[model samples]
Target: MNQQHPSMEVMCHVHNCKFNENDYCFAPKLEVNPLQGSGASNSKEALCTTFQPR
Candidate 1:
């Protein structure tokens, strides 16, 4: 299938990130993971640190 944004890429470093050298995210889909504590209080509602937008 064709993607809407060809330049868009997503990655996930929460536990086991699946990003390669080509900046491609191999995750089947994006999911939300609940955070614990105040470390990421100032961040967005959801975190996708592994995401790399082209």
Candidate 2:
């Protein structure tokens, strides 16, 4: 059976991101993308696409 994850509040710690508001992610949505050719093999290979430099 398929299961869906529940939505929860997002917390942000990146001070340079434009969406960061009071240590929280103020973006309406967030997306994580792979930065490698064959997809992310590890956490280091992924990027927060919602980041906008302040």
| Residue lDDT tens for model 2, 1-54 | 899765878888999999998998988789989996759889899989999999
Colliding pairs, model 1: 11-51
- After superposing candidate 1 on the true structure, give the runs of residues whose Cα lies further than 4 Å from its correct spot: 1-8, 11-16, 19-21, 37-40, 44-54
- How well does candidate 1 match the true structure in TM-score terms? 0.30
lDDT of each: 0.49, 0.88
Give per-model CA RMSD. 8.2, 3.4
Q: Which segments of candidate 2 are over 4 A away from where they belong? A: 1-6
C-alpha TM-score for every candidate: 0.30, 0.71
The best candidate in terms of lDDT: 2
Cα RMSD of predicted structure 1 = 8.2
Worst 10 residues of 1 by lDDT: 12-21
Candidate 2 clash pair list: none
- What is residue 26's positional error in candidate 2, in angstroms? 1.0
